[model samples]
Target: MTTSTKQRPEPMSVRRRTPAWAKAVIALVAVLAVLFAGLRLSVLPGLRDLFGMDTHDRSGPVLLRSIQDMSRYEAASGTFQVVVDLERDSKYLPSAIRGTRTLYVGAGTVDAYVDLGRVGRQDVTVDADRTSATLRLPHAALGKPTLDPDRSYAVSKQRGLLDRIGDLFSDNPNSERAVQKLAVRHIGEAAKESELTARAETNTTAMLDGLLKSLGFKEVKVSYGT
Candidate 1:
């Protein structure tokens, strides 16, 4: 008994300490929350400005190129998109050391046209009464691929250590000329393989037929030259 024996030892006061990682996570979350609030409130200059995102266009004034009269009728046009992947690799080095790769998304339009200026007196045949007419027209031709700057862009690019270092001294380091040329070539090839010309011929024929009928021709026969 001895004075109710030694007082029961007070339960050791246990204080759990938060792990370092957990504390760090909490701090990061708090910072992010504050940033989000600032962004939402428009009190920040935005992430882009904060990260020094900027662009300066020092392009020269556009010169007026020579103008030429055009007499071609664009009968059909086709919109096209292509992905160009171009790469260059060093013969004795790995990609990470001396290689470069680019991915570009190109958008353009190809026009199918009939050159009305090419048609002459010999190309048209008319009956004595002028009630019937026949037109021999040149085959539809494809126009140059016109790339859309607004819709065409470079998706991604990767360069090796040496290549990146070299770019620092290059005049046009981020040039997309190669990929743009490839894209144009691919688009031209695709247009050639498509039925765009055939469609153009059909449309031109319809247009001619309607016009001839309105002009008092009872019969209109349209044919294409080789």
Candidate 2:
């Protein structure tokens, strides 16, 4: 009995082929991982430029408006800062129900100028020898307070329940008009109280003295009028 035992068929080794989409997806994931690592480590300096992350100013062209000749001499400038705490409340309601409060910090500049255009021939008196001179000038006047938007900002804002609710439905709900106006007023008052006009007068006097001395005037008298 030559019993040739049936040899068990060797099990075929099954190999599964990866799909094209799967290979592509794996490559993309690997590339994204590398990019994220580079970004986190800040190793790629040109990435921000490639991504266009820089600020672009798309403002329109600045139109030329009417121009006026400036004949006033800006002798002195004063910088002023003020804190404005403004609040509004409804008369019939409680503070928590109908009220708004804002704390704003404002910075501005005030210029003190002398109007040279107002000087007339009669205001300038020359002595007989033409060596002495007297000039009657107008007192230095303060210009309008120019608020600096870059330096001015709102520090805090608190709104009541009604005010908060109304803001959702209103356009420009976060308008700071009232606070800005108050800030400007306070800055103006502070500028008025400062010695900017006095400083301007001193500078103007020095300037005129130098100018007159160079013009061969031995005695230069500058008197200011109201």
Q: In model 1, which regions exceed 4 Å deviation?
A: 1-65
RMSD of 1: 9.5
Candidate 1 clashing pairs, residues 3+ apart or interchain? none
Query: TM-score, each model?
Result: 0.73, 0.73
The TM-score obtained by model 1 is 0.73
Q: With candidate 2 superimposed using the best TM-score fit, by how many Å does residue 171's alpha carbon deviate from the native?
A: 2.1
lDDT tens readout by residue for model 2, 1-226: 6878898999999999999999999998787556434344245787656766568899999999899999999999999999999999999999788999999999999999999999999999999998999999999999999899999999998887778768868898889999888888888888889999999989999999999999899999998997
lDDT of 1: 0.91
Q: Cα miss at 105, model 2 (Å)?
A: 1.0
Model 2 is weakest, by summed lDDT over 10 consecutive residues, at 34-43
Model 2 reaches what TM-score against the true structure? 0.73
